[model samples]
Target: MKNLKKKLGLALAVTLSTVTFATAYSTTAEPTTAATSENVNENTIRNDEPTSDRINQFKDIAMYYYWHGGDIQQAEKDIFKGITLKGKYDVVENAFKEATLLDPYDLDLKLSLASTQIIQKKTPEALQTYKQILNLDPNHFNANLLYGVYSKVNGDNSSYKSSISNLKQIDAKKTNEYLQKLETTETILDENLNTSAPADLPQKDHAIVILGYALAEDGSMREPLIERLKAGLAIAKQYPNSKIIVTGGVPKQGITEADAMSNWLISQGIEKDRIILENKSTDTVENGLFSTAILDKEGIKDVTLVTSASHMRRALTVFKEASDFYNKMNGNNIDRNFTNVVYLDYPSLEEAHKVSKDEILVIYRDLIRTSGIWQYPGLQR
Candidate 1:
């Protein structure tokens, strides 16, 4: 009876241990199995779901971070991280592509995507995207303008003419003016194609116009502004007789770009009377428009325009176009020639292999504005 009792107790102990071990095993295994199953389900859904649905989902997430989150900087960072940081162009392209799928009516997104495609050298894709934009808004200013410029650059003269015609319907006065300038440009291009002329340096006695950049938040000159100023100063020193015009506005609280430029030039020993302050213009288009008015008042016909290299092409084009319009409006068309403006490129701190698509798009926009297709917002006369 003693031996039977011992054996029965041992068996009970064994049974309890097995049960405990099984319980512990299940506790660990069940959660892991559940987690794996969840992951698999997600993968399956991603694979099986329609692309449009997935695109909408991604766009919804992007919109949440872009607007509802109230953190635009963070949103831009997240959206552009793949491209800006990792140089993963495909990732950003895909994101924009997906986002556009859900919001086909968003003109801005389409423009952005098309610009990115151009930057990537995907010309065919960009053309298709531009076509899509036109389908949505046939007379979209930016779309037609950019498409025209792109077509012109790619040597598609037929498309270029078509785009110009479209623009004419949108703004006839501006289109006529731009068409004249376009013909002039083509003539110059033809001349250049036949014979390369020696590069002519800027004349020292020409009026010097220093284009303004944004000032630092503390009212100090930002590096870009300082660089522009430095270039202006050098030119001013070289051309003591030339009148200097500094163009910019008080975009921040403390001071205007013109003010900073004027102060810097004064400190460098330029006379106050020689410097003209144009502090009301906010953007490049306004810079050209306002500065041209000043030039008209001063009876100045020639100018040496100074700005960053990355911005040089647009700046030169707008200033020339603005001056032409001003001349025509004021009936000062004795020669019908645009202003004799020369460009001086101040290299930007950022290095790029080629001009970016964004820059090109901005050039087109400014060109359209200069053509008088659209007036500056809140502009008086």
Candidate 2:
């Protein structure tokens, strides 16, 4: 019986060691068929879901793309498509809410969602989102910067001050830099708002700047382009000695708007030497930034900014802001003015009515850009 007991104990020990070895092998091995089958089942469910379910699935897909796959642009497009298809602010809010749950630490996701909320006029929701971001990461640079701008636009002076204070504490260099530009913008905006009309043209020695519009597909001068060039020519004729600055860069066919404008102006008997073509700018902000650099280099401080009446507000604001930034950076006190705007009439009243929202948003966006946030690449102009 003692021998039998010893044999049984030996058998139990061998069985236990084998079981342990098998468990270790299972744990260290590559994923098993069960895991693969589970993934397949998930894919099957996703494929079989209804259209709404498929659409809602984008939240998870976007998160995966952003975090796991490291494809930010694709993730952004996926989220954007979800919002676009829904066409409702609440739906967008919900999509962001679900995404945030998946990646609670994602600052970019929070900022994008907040921006969307602001665009949708969901101020309270946006404010909450901003608060959440600040709470998560108190020193988040973009969050603080954009929150300040948005607060100012929303007329929440208290929140704006708080955000600015927080910015100063977290990043004093950026705060001071942005403050200077913000002050310049505020001064210009106040002056602009108080004045009803464009300033009268300076009598002498001031440059004439014609903001270019779109050229035809074949690089031909179109109506508005022709109108703007004509208006600039009239101003040039008035101040024959003053240089003409033609600003635009978007190309058609093979020629830029500035090139088209220059050709048209030369064709209409304007001297080529008197025309300064700024063919590097792509948008109004670039137009202002690039044109001002040339103006400063040429010692042209006073300018008669000419564009369509609908565009005058934004164009003038951007020009003034750019000029202010240029002057501040160069330590030169130049008196930049947009006193004279030769209005190129819009095609019709309907087109004119399409101006206000776009104009205001551009002005606000450029002001933020001028404040040293979201700066484009290049010479920091």
Candidate 3:
């Protein structure tokens, strides 16, 4: 009877050991589902059931959110998180590769990978990635755009020229599409410009007007600039406005356009109270954004955003996008809100010399404006 009890006890020990081992193995080596296509049924994605499908759903959600809100960094982070949370790097890499394979026609993924490689300073890899994109799509607009940007960043002027050349080769209809976008932008701007703000247009009590970018140190006002500023100041002067934020930092550290403009405007005998000097914004976007902040803090809301007539569309867009005018009025609960704005233009005489190249410039300018996050947000027009 004692021997029988000893054998039973040994069998219990064996059973417990097997159970523990199984538990440990199950915990450590969990079956990981890859965030890949074949492993995930596309239909299951909408239901969010399978692990891979859930990951895909997360990716789609993140992408949609980012696209609408203009939040790319967040999108990238979310995508990386969704893939990596599966606890597999190879799986993530394979997913990215599978994405490229599945949509062999799409260069965005390839371009994204190339941009990542460029950021990591992996030039050879970036080059290979771009080459692969070019192999798949010889005339991909984004590929050319990024190639030009990378070339310019790396001082590869030869490559830049090649990329620019390739961009020029886009068919007329596609080029027209870009132009139509600009035309639509201009239509909105013109509609806004030609109309008077509501009877309760916010009055700028002590606002500043910053004369943005223009040719440096040119003594005389260019015709376009003159016409634009004249129209702008005429409308603004009707509002009993107190100050002008004349701002422009030197693109090159010589006599800045802002100083020249201030001197010229003051020479016209505009009161010193009317001009608040801000001779320190190098680019148009900075001129608008930084000036908006400064003026907003000073309790000024009505602004005449003076720039070339040609630049009014972009300037207005930037102000709309970046300025605190909207938030400040709503935050302070100030019923007497003022977001009044105007545009000016001053195309240089030197433009006459380049009249022959206007067609080319028009195309190249639009391409450059649309291809990247330019220094000025709305200046594409």
Candidate 4:
């Protein structure tokens, strides 16, 4: 849950957490007429971008490493089956450097590198990547939006203002709309993060919303998820009268995350009648939307969201957006915000507070999708 979710989010906050993702983009330049096939083959492993076929092959290798949190050795062993010309990259950063060197003009790849750098606490390097991204394409939508948010969060008003100007000029309607929603989400995030998970919550309209993690292939709970469940159990006992909602639909070996979570809670002495199961969602976005719909039907208003600290921000933001959407649809005056959250620090709490660049990017990305800006299924970039 903790760093695992964030690490997964680093790829595409809104994509397959444990699945491979190779976006259909070719960054390789066409071979020059004067260059021989031998020269091209030699240069493919060097700085020049390879042919489209070669880039696709590289993607299968690189994304598997990313999916496994940069376990390059395993990626090479599994994806390539004992072949990678770049040799052993002991660090994830080196893998990123290798990818960028091979496909220097890929904006999405650069963003991924910047995100990894930011997560690794290489702020100056990440910032330089952002500069390089802007240089590559001045009007890149995601680049400007994220750069703006990064600048604002880091107290660089100059960059933030400059970004805002660029965004407004780029697409005033869409950018302004997203910016407005961003303000609302930021307020919710700041207020909730400052406040601790309550010792007691009102029972009349409150529910402990526990966002679920995927189960092991054999349907057993992983350590991170077990930690989250432990935290949720504590919260449930504290607010014994409140309802509990476990949300996740991804199943492993025929066992859904919600079903396994509910079963565990039942085994731990929680009544089945008290726990509401949202077992149809495949990802966080669906968790928010489907869970909010269930809450609406049950007449629940206040919610205390429970998840890992790495996932808390995105969950809170997306849930808030979904809640607002549902409230507007139902014409209810109740403000349904995930303002109260309990986060399990999987590795440590200190690391959870440091939001990665990918998480920051996806908060808005998911919010916009929850806002109905995009109708597509998976995240594009």
How many clashes does each candidate structure show, in the order listed?
0, 1, 18, 0
Model 4 residue runs over 4 Å out of place are: 1-50, 69-71, 74-106, 118-121, 192-206, 213-243, 249-256, 279-286, 293-300, 308-314, 324-334, 339-381
Tell me the lDDT of model 3 at 295.
65
Q: Assess candidate 1 and give its lDDT.
A: 0.60
The true-versus-predicted C-alpha distance at residue 334 of model 4, in Å, is 6.9
- For all the candidates, what are their Cα RMSDs to the real structure? 18.4, 16.9, 20.0, 9.0
Candidate 1 TM-score, C-alpha based: 0.56
lDDT of 1 at 17: 33
Estimate the TM-score of every prediction.
Answer: 0.56, 0.62, 0.39, 0.62
lDDT tens string, model 3, 1-381?
Answer: 222212111222222333332222111112223333445432222232344433333323322222222223322332333433322222223334544654556565565445435433555666677778777787877666556645554557788777767767965555544445444444434434332223443454645354555653344445554544454455445655556667776633356666666666666666656766677675555666667666666776555555554554455545543343435444754332233344422244233123222222233333343334341122211
Query: Please, what are the lDDT tens digits per residue for candidate 4 over residues 190-237?
Result: 543422457546767888888898788798988767877888888788
Model 2 CA lDDT for position 256: 94
TM-score of 2: 0.62
> Per-model C-alpha lDDT, please?
0.60, 0.62, 0.46, 0.66
Lowest-sum lDDT 10-residue window in model 2: 24-33
Q: Which 10 consecutive residues of model 1 have the lowest summed lDDT?
A: 25-34
Candidate that beats the other on lDDT, 1 or 2, i.e. the better one? 2
